[model samples]
Target: DARVTQTPRHKVTEMGQEVTMRCQPILGHNTVFWYRQTMMQGLELLAYFRNRAPLDDSGMPKDRFSAEMPDATLATLKIQPSEPRDSAVYFCASGLAPRGSGEQYFGPGTRLTVT
Candidate 1:
């Protein structure tokens, strides 16, 4: 019964508030991904990692978004001084796809609302 779990499933914050979200990836999966979905941008990859090591984060806004894997099963994404434009659903996914093609099992996303 392994699956990714996310905390604070829903969040509402005033503009400029710092927000942190946590994810517990499915055991045995080495590759983790962070994604964001908004009305304008359909699900977009923000970061990708293998063995707790970051492989790519080009899609993430360098100034405000950060993603990290501190341990095998734990990953986190943080936004400091979040803005209304940052309001969106953030998702964490994990799977074995190093060969380059595999479907990701997504956790229930964290819905953030900024005003």
Candidate 2:
């Protein structure tokens, strides 16, 4: 049984610092997604990758948000020059099936707070 795992489930940092969050998607899954959730934005799709290739990232703020897949099971999301508004729960999800037909299994999430 494989499950998505996230690191640093809770993080508190001062403003303008770099933060890195990681995730391990389920095995045999090729599609990975990064999402941010907050009071203002219920669930914002930041980006996704298919077969380690970026599919779409139009929902992410290009200035400070970045996502990458270093390998098959590992994915990462990074925030630079962090701000208070950037504080939220970041989730990494993986699709067990095709990009459109699969249900996404989400990690526990990494809670980031910038003050």
Candidate 3:
């Protein structure tokens, strides 16, 4: 069966360490998204992509994080010089475009903890 897969299921790093998370969306899904959830802010959409192109990432801190689809099957989110406040669970979800026509498939998610 097809599924969304995220790498390094968990991560723990010191304040200045860089973190890289990866995702592989279910095959054939053209739209992908990145989301982050923390106790304080709840869930927030960090990035959106369609057909391997990034469409929006305004919800994320531009200087600290980056989201990209290197190809059809792979999506990546990276945080450089991570801070303690960046601790959170990050999720990658994929679905068909045209907005809400189908259900979204989400990966188990990558959990990051910065100290």
Clashes of each: 0, 0, 0
TM-score of each: 0.93, 0.94, 0.95
- Report the C-alpha displacement of residue 98, candidate 2, in angstroms: 2.5
Tens-place lDDT per residue, model 1, 1-115, is 7788998899999999999999988888889999999999899999989999999999999899888898987999999989999999999999986674687889999999999
Residues 1-115, model 3: lDDT tens digits:
8899999899999999999999999998999999999999999999989999889989989998988899999999999989999999999999998865778899999999999
Q: Kindly report which residue stretches of model 1 are placed more than 4 angstroms away from their true locations once superposed.
A: 99-101
Better of 1 and 3 by lDDT: 3
- In model 3, pairs of residues that clash are none
Best by lDDT: 3
lDDT of each: 0.91, 0.91, 0.93
The residue-by-residue lDDT of candidate 2 on 11-111, one tens digit each, is 99999999999989889889999999999879999999988889999998889988899999889888898999999999999995453576899999999
* Candidate 2: segments with Cα more than 4 A from true spot: 99-101
User: Which structure is stronger by TM-score: 1 or 2?
Assistant: 2
- The better-scoring model by TM-score among 1 and 3 is 3
